[model samples]
Target: MPLPDPSLLFRPLRKLYRRLPLPYALRVLLGRIYRRIGSPVNRAIQQRILANSLFRPPHCHLQESLDSLPDYLFWGVIDWDFRHQRPQHLAEQLSLGGRRVFYISSTLQDDPRAGFALRPLDQTGRLFEVRLFARTAPIIYHIAPDATLACQLRRSIGELLSWANTHQVVSLIQHPFWTPVAGVLPNSRVVYDCMDLHQGFGNNAVELQDLERNLIGAADLTLFASAWLEQHWHQQIPRTPAQQWAVLRNAADFDYFSKPAQHPCQAPDQGPVIGYYGALAHWFDVELLAAIAEAFPHCTILLIGADTARIGARLRHHTNVRLTGEVPYRQLSAYLHAFDVCILPFRIESLTMATNPVKVYEYLSAGKPVVTVDLPELHEFQQQVTIAKDQQAFIDAIARALQAPASSAESRQRQAFAAQQTWQHRVQALLALTEGTQQQPRVSVIVVTYNNLAFTRDCLASLTADPQGQPLEIIVVDNGSSDGSVEFLQQWATSYGQTLILNDSNRGFAAANNQGLALARGEFLALLNNDTQVTAGWARTLRRHLQRNPGLGLIGAVTNNIGNEAKIDIHYQNSQEMAVRARQYTWRHAGLIVPCATLGFFAVMMPRSTYERVGPLDEAFGLGFFEDDDYCRRVEQAGLSCAFAEDVFIHHHLSASFAQMPGKQRQLLFERNKALYEAKWGRPWTPHVAREKP
Candidate 1:
């Protein structure tokens, strides 16, 4: 009657196919065919399997093991037993420092027992390996998850948190797949550990670049593995504070690699032994290896590690080269000791240019002579390591390294340099950065809302999109909305822990803002309109400029739709294009400030001291029109200047509430505000105009 679930027939075939004894090429070809033909059915079966695994209770030992230790959840990009690179090294160091770490692997398992499995990596039980059992592909390869899978993953993570009895964590995310997971974690602080230019990976889709952008925006602290990578991101997203990102380059385990190997690997006794051990993928230089083999006919070119790109075929004919595939991490030191010279022969590409190789640190730690290709990250270590500019130079460097004795003074200097660059030192620096983020200066962002709910929602979304930029204390004042804005504000305020001031009747714009200003408690205060959309790092950029100039009393951001000198002409069709244009504009005008007679109050920031000295907006200009001009005049009268930050951009939907007002009523309100402003200033009011581009 049930039609015997179609997936049941394919399960055994899938298991058998994986276990079949076949050549690497044949296995790959067969796997691709299987995936192509069975994709839809397999996805359905995987969804069913995951659905059944939810709400399962944790093991009895898990609770006791995680007790009393501060927890760190690593949304890992690789399996724990894989390459033993940055992710594994960092987790091990954190665990050694007395923190419990749960590493959720990207490699999934197929088992009927449970939805997930947790196993301790060692006896201390501080480090745990998490394996999610599923038949579908890992979520790391996709830009987003489907609705069904997303619901299951969220519920699964919730169950994990409930079992552990913790409401918050320090989430160290290594890839973009974990971005959505970080959003659902209650009050969790996110750290983005960017180790590579992910778009350069061969198997990854181009869409992952966009996902990485989202993850970077969500992270509280971003750690780049190389100076080049940090500089790359700096040019892409300009105008952020220096404290938001740091270059925590790759390092080695000094004590482990410095000691002599207990059992060294056997090598050819006659000629020199040239060695390299790491992942041999698209970036690996197989042709370079062949050239090296041909140049040194008597040398034994030992190539160790997993050949993921199937490069062994290219070098199989070389008689002197030996490929020992996929060695364990503990056995690497043995091979390093047996080598006469170590060389890194990687292709010159975008991915390899940004790589801060861990093997170089390990090779130097072992007191071996090292020669590497031209990589930007290796420039700092040119004194201790031989950096070659071309293929011929690389080969020559290797010959020189081979001639040098292992116990020379140069070897001791290399070892000394590496001792200071250990995993422990790197971990300590990382922990210090996290601690620094916790002490960020709080900023109060005040937004006054009227009847337009759609604009208000978009404004709040843009404000909170970048949680990593500046710590904000959001205060929202509602001017009696009949369009269900109050109910939405109530729920939003509760969700994000924001302050809401709900007035029973329509309060004038200046008066509503005054209410929020009175309740504000921050070193910096920003006034944002409900119809504006702000760019990332807007507040931090404005705050940095304000702090740098003591004479400046108030600052406003350049916008596309503003009436005064702060307006800048911009061209964009959509939000994504708008963000790109904003970044380009900000980078072009970085640190350039323009003194303005009057800045629009639609978006503005000032220090608390300035606010205290200049005082509040005049409520006499009822509704909205000339309160900003009045405030600017007061700031100048108090012996301070008002300026606009040229490095920041905010998008304004100009006068959303005012546009709805009747023509006669709007004109009357504007004329009344003009008279009140002119009377106070003792002169006729002149409308502001845009400044000429410098």
Candidate 2:
């Protein structure tokens, strides 16, 4: 079989996007501002009206901390809202995994004058957000020499930097565009999730070479969706660090296909149905499918998918072949479930050799036995898939699968194996590719301060007062205070040989804390508020608890000012009073720790591994509010618990920073924060009185 023409497959997509109407120098400026302001509220109350829409983005939800976003900015090989592909599958699963996913649809389906449009994919909001840029191509497959067109596209794309920065997007996973516009996205990593050879693009081969080079050099990891492609890419590019490249095979959306077929349709009762769903492209073996149809004249061959190219008269003329045409990806499960056997007859050509058919895995999820041409890529799925060497074998395999009981152990094994290859599993592997592999420190204590020099001084004094000799590393981040807090802390940290990070202004609690966290080197990180004075041995006690319960993600001490469950019978009159009561409380409840779902970050400690898994605090809450609650919830999602160190006591000067603000501002902040928290977690924040056993 000859190699498929790239122009036939992808050029039209570029044409579609280029026809749609559509930012760049704006990118450089926005990137600069975003680094300072974090994320501005997406207050676009009006939706961009359009003539036609393949998919729409949802209205921006009320601010749910920047931390809640999906770790990736997914740019599908085509529009995500278009045909369901690898990116869409991964994005859907990742979204269900609790990360906000935004699919970049570009402006392919809209008019050149169309404005931006946003609409929720579903009421549950787990379907992922899709946005289309007016005047942009469905997929930018080729690089152009026209800088003006590029600028307009990037300037429009630059608008998303706020989303990128606000979400602290860790990676840009998709096609590479050359410009500072992409550089402005505040993403720590980039992934050229290579599914096909860049050389596959018909035109602009030279430009494609440059683009791939840029992507390869810029990408922290280049994960191939197929093993053959992984090896092919390696042979093309000069060998780099092997760790930077890996194979993350395409998998099915198990949850989607596992759902019993809805609105089931009965096929010809006498004949078994053999189904196939995918674009009828060059890689598809028309001759092979024709032969199968000839050998099994009684079997109904159901071809369910878009006919991207011309279909051969041979298969089209088959009396038993039923071309149901294209349907939405969500509806494909119904067709698959209606089948007794599935087939993936691909031409044994260069185009098919390296391809990994996503639909085959999806078919397996439905327990429809798959018979396919024996290709290198199919070997990976050999355990679950039947290798069809010839027309006779293909016919025999389909007959066997059709004859097998629906609930037979063979069918169950196929389903079980596909379940393990869900988009969730692949997403876990994707995340591993997007993170750095640095050796973390054993323990790092982080403290953020806005003002209140006395509270800050007292807090530091008490923490240092206890000489535990445990190699305790302290990091103090000062969020520009009008008082002499920065200067004093700078000098103090220097004298004590601790780390000090200074910010120009009060960037808010989450931002400041995240900054300190970025600098931390320990395996364990304790977030201590500047207004809290720790008791002697408080750190030692919490660290010991973490050591004892290796599985616990969060361990925080009780304080008189906050944490209803952690509060003891003491309020601070002064720093002197705090010191006295701390010693007394420590003796009263020694070695007592209570397991709880929620804990205060005021003096909470967690392992660096937990931080890596759950990520930094959400900066969207602004100035210091419910981000800690968000953090705890994220920790819980990671299968870890937050426990209170009941035996330990710390003194908290509640609302010390809020004291400087006017009453109205403080109240407004509280109301705003409360609303956001409710929207994100639906927590009522009903203050509970500490319940102590007699």
Candidate 3:
């Protein structure tokens, strides 16, 4: 019948393929090939098939399961079953601390029936392993996601959140693959957990490096696995706030590793066992291990973990060396009990230099003597670990470690030190940093007045108290107001103890605002038109967004009357109605933000750091026709975003000062500023239009 449908024929083939017991390695290779050759429709069909396999309970059921608990979704770098490392440890600790965690794995199941599975990882049901089934999985491990794949992943994540009715989320990103998807989650905070020098992998280095820079710039808190990584990136991206980054080194599960092995290793009859565990990747020092095997001819050298670099042939000839492939995490302690000395033999490279090995901490927890190459991170643990500079020194250190007794002072001291550096402690510090428990950030409000006495008084009165109880520093600039505005401001300043700047002549809007900006002392700065009256919690809401979204440099408030996209239709006729309308709108669109190319400066806020980087607004814009647009363009150029908070509504008596100017003069000012902006940027300006209501 018109050539049998291709999908119908392939359906049987797909079923047959799923029934076949294919090797995992082969499946992974096939998945990679499919990613390269599969059509968008085929990939989408595969994702849908996977999604259908999961047992998705009712929304209310999922909601009740995680009632009143905070959520942390980890965009994981490795699978939960893969080597239990930093990502697993952190997720486990957070879940234990009364937060529900969903760890999305990089590894994808190949079987069609294996769909997107959400497996509970702990008995408490707080920890989950989210297994995504898609052919694009292998592609993301080394490179960033393409647009199509990012859209697909975002939809999948949105679905998962909807099932749980998650309102607030903290996305803990462990790899650069998730960089493009950062800050897209609703009411979410983003954290970049930098565990490795990703560019050192040498597979798509340029793309990886670029993505990392963007991730660091956008993350609310970027955690470095080592102090060296923190300092290195700090120097690289100096524009980012110093407080935005912190060093959170890898730690071990002390109780798990410290417990004596239930079954001891069956040693080779005569000699001691010198062991090393973890991934045998490119950075692994195979040459050093070979040398150690040759030097310790009498000893048995055991290597555990997957051999990803195919270095087994090089070590096979060493009769005394043994390679025990990947072992389960629970069984690792048994091997650790048999070792006379544990070693970290890594080459001196950019990657290794930045590594803060998790195995070192685990080794110490088991009270084992440790020997490692001269990695910078080990210098702090030199007393607990032996640092060897070369192959000869490594062998010598191993010999010394073997000679030390099991219950020696150094062994006991190593255990004692590791006890204090548990994963629980690291998670506690991380929670404190992400929870915004530090001192409240100060806000400086600048109201540029030009004879709008009533509006100015209302704006000033609204600032008397802050909803968040943060210290407020109000700075009022009277730009040659002749309606007794300067006298009123002087008396108001005297009464409120606020700063005042008086101009003898009518300075342009940009100039007057710049004068106020220069005297601003708060960590956050806001430019408010004297014609607008702010609502309660307006400043706090804007500051909260800035704190939660590091990528957003400048944010403006939605108002009832504005010329740009920020203007939303309203039905309020008086101040009382206005307050009620604002409250209703805010509740309906809580935490909603609309990213825009330009944000009006009628009521805009930005951090002090952003102001410092973008500098003051262009004075050439004169009376502020295109000054906001120019500043927004500069912010975008500096790799930041501009958006308006849909939840924060202010009352604007539109253009109170500009309306007083004669029509001809106002038109002349707009034309001149438009020409200046076009000439400076070599692009035609796009005139602002009101946003269409949905």
Candidate 4:
């Protein structure tokens, strides 16, 4: 017998992988491609491609964001425990602007329950800290080999946002991995911060580079810290009409660091103090520091802050060098005052090449004479400070800085420059994005149920438990539910001020939803299924996004058991797991509203105008099989866009109500509806047995 083909043997596995929920299989493919391309040149090309495709400029604005921005949610890259990078400075300033901030740390906590640890980020009592404690897929956990962690974090954050009663979350996130969560956050205005280049990612160059492109595509605004980074992204990433972004160089915290220090006078053995404070590692340029220490044996060279590697060890034994193992932030000013001159001796590698050093302005704030390496980020800082091209040039620049007057006209210019480069200004520039944006509330939910009382109960329970109490009118059209659902709904309507449409018999999905449509008063109308459980604040979230882009005619959230791109397996084993997964999914794709052709009525939200224009679901497709498609086609003809809100997740029990009917009858109706739908829309509406993702 001939040997069987290998393609047949592996085809089943490939098919199984492909069947995995929306984006999961795609992410897996990206991960595999990333692993295969080990060469740096190929990796750079891949990185460029990812940044181009993955990232996006801002697409939506918040209420009064142009006039006066509200509270913020920061998908921060740096933790306070790590470097006090741009996010920290901007968040504090934004809080000072009378807005609360929830800074999400990049470090994932080990405990799942610890995912949402709330703590005070600053003494102001306004800025809060929330951590994303995502479970890692050990062997497969290669940064974002897939959106596993992104999905996990996004879901949890969504729940947290609902529970906190925080809507209209304007966020600034750096990592492309966390961009999905930014997409899913309620009424979010996401700005993707390009602080560093892929080459600067060091060990994570490939993975982070891969994710950067998607982050660009997902963000409503893309911000580049350096012109170098902006130019590179422009060269690599293709522009979209929806992509809106700009460049803003990193600034310094002048007010906090500018005031002259009161304590810690010059060191007892100081010849001329040359101090460097920041992380000490590969970027520290140990050889240069050693060269400086050797050249100036009489001068005291101070190295402050923590060390990640053995680079600090080598500097410790130098006679002229003093390594002060990390000092409190409060004492940093004093330490700066103690230094006669400040120096940034960095390795001229890809990492340093792209860095807009946070210390440059800090040094200027102290009015200290500074010397640094030749960096593209420092091109604007010329004439005030010396830029060294090599070790010899570095030594000469430091000598020049030391020789120059500490408070000359050049020094005054430096201080003036630093004063203008404050965090307050950076934040204002950031918020300027929301200029002339209109905000409005819009959403009416219409749920249809047959006999699935259990799922209906859970759905109402979730809807009723909304923390924000955002104004939403719930209308339930009982399609002749016999399992006490109508009774429960009657009581629910009486208690909760919901609109109930009573029918004596099954009116089918189209007629029932049409019945609810007649009663809906909000700007947007949602058609939901009784057999599906809505996550907390599902209506509110859907409404926020519908308001996000007014051009959208209809929007549907992803579901646990929905078909095609909307399907996501949240690994539901229990109610807690369900909640966890739902929240994660919500936060992960919070801002990602993709233009779609078809939206299932199982849980779909559409504008009131769309319904008025396209009219209700066609009752022609009886028993509700392809009415949604026919309606969607009409919407298309009306020149309105349909979209999928990937950030929202609903738990669907998989045709629970439909499964109860006779198989032949259900099949017959489905065929009849398919025929009616195809006849009406000039396209086949058959079961998607061999279909491709749209």
> Per-residue alpha-carbon lDDT of model 3 for 84-112, expressed as tens digits?
99999999999878888889887654433
Superposing every Cα of model 1 onto the true structure, what RMSD results? 15.2
* Top of the candidates by TM-score: 3
Name model 4 segments beyond 4 Å from true: 1-70, 112-115, 123-125, 136-142, 145-151, 315-317, 434-694
Better of 2 and 3 by TM-score: 3
Deviation from native of the Cα of residue 581 in model 1, angstroms? 46
- lDDT score for residue 535 of model 4: 67
Cα lDDT of candidate 2 equals: 0.69
lDDT of 2 by residue, 1-694 (tens): 2323424444575476456553556556655775564332211111122222232222455234233243456664566566888877787666666656666663343334322345556455444454535443434565532455444444444444333323234445566543223322321344677776546545433665676665665455678878888777667677544337788888888888977876765665457888888887656778778877787889888887767656645576788887777888778888888888888887786667777889888988987788998889889889889998887888788878778888888788889989998787888887665544522135688889988999999888877774322356889988888798888997998899999988898899899889989989887789898888776556656765675577899998878877467766775577666655554444334345688767777889987789899998999899977787778888998988888976577778787887888999888998898789888886676544575745
Better of 3 and 4 by TM-score: 3
Off by over 4 Å in 1: 1-54, 63-70, 109-115, 133-139, 437-694
Kindly give the stretch of ten consecutive residues in candidate 3 with the minimal lDDT sum.
Answer: 58-67
Model 4 per-residue lDDT tens digits across residues 381-415: 88667888899998977787777776688777888
TM-scores of the models, in the order given: 0.61, 0.55, 0.66, 0.61
Alpha-carbon RMSD, candidate 4: 14.8
What's the residue-level lDDT of 316 in candidate 4? 68
